[model samples]
Structure formats: structure tokens, C-alpha cells
Target: MTDIDHELEVKAVAALSDGPFKCGTVAIVGRPNVGKSTLLNHILGMKLAITSRKAQTTRHRLLGIHTTDDTQYLFVDTPGFQQKHLNALNKGLNKTVTQVLTEVDVVLFVIEPMKLGDADRKVLQLLSDKTPTILVVNKLDLMGDKGNILPLIQDFDLEFPFSEIVPVSAKKSLNLDELLKSIRTYLPEQEAIYSEDELTDKNERFLAAELVREKIFRLLGDEIPYSVAVEVEKFEVVGKLRRIFCAIIVDKDSQKPMLIGKNGEKLKQISTEARQDMEKLFGGKVYLETWVKVKGGWADDARALKSLGY
Candidate 1:
């Protein structure tokens, strides 16, 4: 927030007849495993998006609203565009990516420094011509040469005329202030779209389910995480305490034991971590109950996928 930028923000608000607020939708788009959800979580200063090392952790479009004193940014975190391992689930996730691109006011195309691949190019192709995209070079802390960043930016600059280029490290919380400012500059002069205190469009139930799924992704191995889906069977708010009952859906019977672990230890650990996260997110006491259920071939079944909220 420079002095000049602050002054411009003030003038844009009072100078306009509507109000002195700026609000717009921002879409964070990138290929699978490119840290799109991580960047969104970092920008909002909270863990609204569920991120894991495994790709396709985010299956649905999530709107995380960050309201500053002067502007409100509705950040849409979409599932990564899948190019490999085509299936019904992947198809739905890929459809989510393209659908969100058409609805946002601006786009943040996050990518690694020099690891651009075919999937990255395919995501770039999905961007609409009318929208101004900021090419965010994420994971800057992983790079050894700071000087080579310019050439990397130029390489992408030739592919598409980006509005601006910002290099940031989402994991280390580096250079994100600049990224936020860059995103705000593209916002239109209008009143806030959502209430100032609202953080996301999703309810607490959705977040609890996603949190459970995140732990499953983080703790599990191999293809087990992909076969897992979380459903909140019950969400009860009693006074200041919240009691949530959740079910972890697995495609096969063999995968059930992996989530439950020996003596149900893995499920216990997952519940404890998820409850702690829910406590932090809700600012209240959370009592979470979790169990594993076998929903064979839910990923491939169309009706089962719909029931699982795919």
C-alpha cells in the first residue's frame, strides 16, 4: 500500500457516485500440481482451500472472499485442469476449470519458475481474451538464480500478453503483498460484492468435509487419496460448540483399512487434526466424529459421483 496507490483508492471511491469500494471476481487457474489452491490459501491469510501434494485435491469451485478496508476480492479456487488419466471424476473436475474461467473479472495464472509443460500450456489456452491475467511465478524460494527469472517471464510474455508478471513464494509467504496489489488494480470500481466480514461462500459444513478430505490426502499414500471422498453426515451447532459427524468414502473395501490404519489409529489422527483445523476456522469448539465407508466404484459411477458431491 504505497501513498500514491492509497490516494488513488480514496479518489476512486469518493469520486464515484456508487461508492469508494472496489470489488471483483478473481480466478486462480493453473494445471494440476501447480500450487493454485496453495496460492489462494496464502493470499487470503487463512486455509480456505484444501491443498495437498496429490493433484486434483480440489474437485469443486470454491469462492474465498477477502475483504480489505478498501476492496473486496472474491477469489475462485477451481480444480486443476486434468490432462492425463481421463475418467468421469477427472472430466467433472476439468469441466469446473473451464466454467470458472468464463465468470471471473481477472485471472491469476500461477506456474512454477521454469517448469512449464504441456499441461501448463493447455491451461493457458483456456483463458479468455477479454480478461486481463496476471502471470504469477510461484515457488520463487525454490529457485537458485534470481537473475534467470526475467528470461523466464519473457518466455511466457511471448506466448501471451499478460497484464503483469509477479514472482512470489506462497509457501514462505513471500512477495504476496505485491500480488494482492496487482490483483486489486484490475478490479472494477464498484461496491463490495459480499459483506465485509464474510470470508467465503461455502458454509461450515462444506469446509469441515474438505478439511477431512485434506487430511486423508496428506496422510494416505499412492492412489488411495484419489479414491477417498468426504461427506458430512451431520453438522450440529450446540451453543458455542460444534459437533460434526463425517464419513470418509473409499472406492474399494481394501482402501478402508488403509484409512482406518491399525487399530483405527489413522482415522483417529485424521479426526484430531481435522477438528483442530475446524476449531481455528470456526473460532469455536469442534467435536468431530469420523469413520470410513466403502462406496465401491463411486468415482466411475455417475450417480455415485453426484451423491459424493463431485
Candidate 2:
């Protein structure tokens, strides 16, 4: 066994004493598109996190809870780790990841099948000092052989002492039982941190805003995906229908041209698609409206991110 592996085994065994039989928070950390959100959703058996083909779509730390007769596991989905960007949005994403690490019972170090690099190394370097980390290799379905997976394991081993290394396909629902078992084996048992009825810490308004943001990601593709943010300007329940209004905040006026398209066709399409998703989530009809606004360089400004509750 590598030194890190041995160290992890020892650490996991030791942490068992911190609690009797219940588990609390487990933070999922990895680079973007590594399926951290997918895993959390699959484990929760619902869509608690917004996911798309684009990177950094998840701007905040989303918590999904799993409960059984005997235990509860609160899983946190965080923004993917990336190099520090000049944009305030990117900085806020990085800050969210670091802050989650501080309070987690265990850290799931998610790695995609693609070759691990300096970004992956940076995660190991950060976790080396805090929490007993479980190296969770996600997206196994995309890979064909042990050869593709072996290097990631070795690279991680070379970097830090991870408590456990387990491969899983969050999208395909593969090997998740083993992953959960391994995670639970290490977490100190504690009272359910949240109520049994609560599936996530995010309220209805936050979920509604994210639903709208996910729609934007789906319709706009790459160019506008990173440049946009969604805010719920109005969310009120009138009888059975929920009336909601949100602004699709963009970084430049040029994006408004693209988002609206010819004769407002694109905006109409986005609103239609977003309204359907919101209706399902709200369990009632949703009257949705999208207004476009450009805030130049909001990406680099901390004040902007904080204002958006980043």
C-alpha cells in the first residue's frame, strides 16, 4: 500500500470513535464536470443540483440529504476547482469550495476518468492538512480500462494520504452503494443535522432561481453559460399558480443580442423551456418572465458576487 493509503486506513479507523452510528455532512469536491452534482442527485434520488454540459454551472454549495431508518448523510455539492480567475464569480466559486472543506465530516475527492493534472493535485494538496478524505473517482462509464484509471490513483497517492480510493459512475448509478458504505464507515455518527423532511438546505426560492439558471445553461450553450447569472426578482404563490420573475444577468450588452435572438425568438424559447421545468418543481403552473441586463465586469467584482449571495 502507498503511504497515503496506509495513513487513510489508520485515520478512518480512528475517526469511528467520534460518533456512535449516525453520519452528518460529507463534502463532494473535484474539478468541473467530474459529476459531483450528478452523484449527489443520484444519491438523493432527485435533482438537487443544477448540472449541464458547461463547466462551473454550479455557483454555490448545494446540500442534498439522504435518510434511512437508522442514518442520515448530508452531501454537499460544491463548484468545481479551477485556477484563480480575475472574475469575481470564479473567485466566489473557489471560496465556496474552501469554506465547505472546513466544516465537513469527510471530503469526497472526485476525479473524472480523464487524466488527472495540476488541478487535481491542488485538491490533494489542500486536503492533505484537513479532514479524512475519500478519493472518489467519478464517471467510470466513460472509461474503458484499468489503464485509464490507474494513473489517477497513482497520481493521487503520490500527492497525499487519502483515506479511501473508490471508483464510481454517478450518472450510471454504479458502485454508489460501496462508496456510501466506505463514507459511512469513516464518518463519526451524530444526530441528524437537519430535519427528516428536509432533503436539501436550499429553500424554494433558491431552488427556483437555480431551475431558471439551469434552463439558461441548456439553451444558451457555452458562450453565455458562464457569462450569465439568475436572480429571482419575484416569487409569489397565488392560489395554485406560482408567479415568478427573474432577470438573466449577463456581463455584456452583446450577450443580450444573442439571448434575445431574432424578433425575441430565443428569449421566448428559453422562457418556455424554463417555465415547464419550474412548474414541475413548484407542482403548479408558473408564470415566468425573463429580462436581460448587462453588468460589465461583474465577474471580477466581489461586491457583485456577494450581492447575488455568492
Candidate 3:
């Protein structure tokens, strides 16, 4: 071979070896109670997004960042697209999901194992074919038979031409590496968007409020959890300590007693648990103070919802 040919071959091999880095936004979307937040927290390896057993627990667009040696994943965990309850709060949440779908580089359409219904289909309608999407069949731990997954994957393939389909158990942290590898394939070659150590875009105050709200959703009965909203009235940071004051808003005066319990024991339990979580997440001691107040139909009121940061 000529010297010129060998030089050209060496350059080509060098170009292929130095592959461009990948960094882009990925949106995680699905119906309520489909373990979207759980998936995000697992990917992040921390509790950045709040979780609960109740539906509609996530009401905002949360950004969780996971950076590896070769790629950085900017995951936007969106609220579950609401179909039934068209209240002011839910409408806002649905808007968040649609807005995120358009802006993301890749879309992770999360759903439960073998249970795709009208609500899941509704979310699928929002996805654009232009954007690379992956069907993440979460909760594989709950599935009894592993053989059923193959047919389930085929069934989902008929609905949309997904770039790739990955079944993951977010709760058990199974097949996450495979899921990340599939996601990295579609990420555009670019520089990192966030710092390597940064975990999320949300501030500590927002996380504190979410922790308190999560406890409420987990501890309380179904009726009261939806009506409640938490606001950090004051967040004072002094060196290694953080002092937080939160207001727990209720829709009616009758509901206040239920949250407060017989002698404020219920609220105390909620505060203690929330504070403990805050310490672990924040890496500092947190003194959390909470109180209940009546908001009188804030969930339906547009003005109230706006004030509450919905």
C-alpha cells in the first residue's frame, strides 16, 4: 500500500476511536401510579423525585441528571397525563407532560407489565415519530412468568415503532444498565449540559416541600392526601444546619383535624419522617416545622393553584 493510503487509514481509525460524547434531555412519561418517579429515583441512585402508592402523586416536571463517563442523561420526570379528573391542578399537570414531550431529545414511555389501558394509550398519542422513543415496561419484579414478556414486547411493537423496547424493574433495579445503554444510542453527540456531581435542577427548598408532601400521600388516607399542598414558608440555612417551616394547606376546616390527628401525633409523625429524609438527601441536619391551614377549594381555583406553585 502507498504511504498516503496508510496515513488516510490511520486518520479514519483515530476518528472512530474518538467518538463524540453524548448529552441530551430524556422525558419519562406515563399515566398516574405507573412508577415513573420510582424509575427516576432508581436511575439517579437517590431520592430526587418523590413517590407514593396513590395516583397523581407527581404533579410537576422534575429534572434528574445522571452522568457517566461517556454520556450524561438529563431525565425529566413529568406528571402522569390526567384523563378523568379535569380539575385546574390536573389540567396544569397534563400541560407539563405535553410541554416536556416536545422539548426532550429522547422519550422513555414507561408502563406497567402486561397492562396497557386507555390511560397509557392516551400518553402514547403525544409522542412524535420524529423523536426516538423507548417502551420501558417497568415492574418486571411483579410479573410471574418471564416468558410472557416476549409477547408483551411484540404487542407493544404493534402500537408504535419504538426505537427500542426495554423491560426494567425500577423497584428492584433490574435491567437498568441495559435501559441506559439503549438510551445512550439515541442521545445526540454533544458536550455535557450539567456538572458531573450535580444530581438535579431543583433546589433544596423544592425537594424539602416534596418530601413533606410524599409523607402526607404515604401516611394519610386517599381522600385527604389530594387536598393537601405543602409550602416551605421559611428556609433558613446556617452553616451545616437548615431550619424549614412548612404550611400544610387543606381544602376545608373539617379536614384539618383529620391531618392533625387526635392530639397532633399524626402531624408530628409526618414531620419527623420528612425531616429524617431531608437530612439524608441534603447531607445536613434539618429542623422542620409544619402547621395545617384551610385553603377552601384551592385545587379547583386557578389563582390558588398558581400561588401554591402548581
Root mean square deviation (Cα) for candidate 2: 8.0
Candidate 3 lDDT trough over 10 residues, lowest sum: 9-18
lDDT of 3 by residue, 129-166 (tens): 99999999999988989999888888888999999998
State the displacement of the C-alpha of residue 97, model 1, in Å, after optimal TM-score superposition: 0.7
On a 0 to 100 scale, what is the lDDT of residue 235 in model 1?
Answer: 96
Candidate 2 regions with alpha-carbon error over 4 angstroms:
1-20, 146-155
TM-score-wise, the better of 2 and 3 is 3
List of clashing residue pairs for candidate 3: none
Ranking by lDDT: 3, 1, 2
Q: What is the per-residue lDDT of model 2 for residues 109-226, given as tens digits with 9 covering 90 to 100?
A: 8987756677777765667456888888887887887676777678767777888889889999999999888888767755555555578878878888898788778787775747
Per-residue lDDT for 10 in model 3?
39
Q: Using Cα atoms with residue i matched to residue i, what is each candidate's TM-score against the true structure?
A: 0.92, 0.87, 0.93
- Model 1 segments beyond 4 Å from truth? 1-20, 223-225
Off by over 4 Å in 3: 1-18, 223-225
Estimate every model's Cα lDDT from 0 to 1: 0.86, 0.79, 0.89
Best by TM-score: 3
In the range 65-107, model 1's lDDT, one tens digit per residue, is 9877677889999998988778899999988888888888999
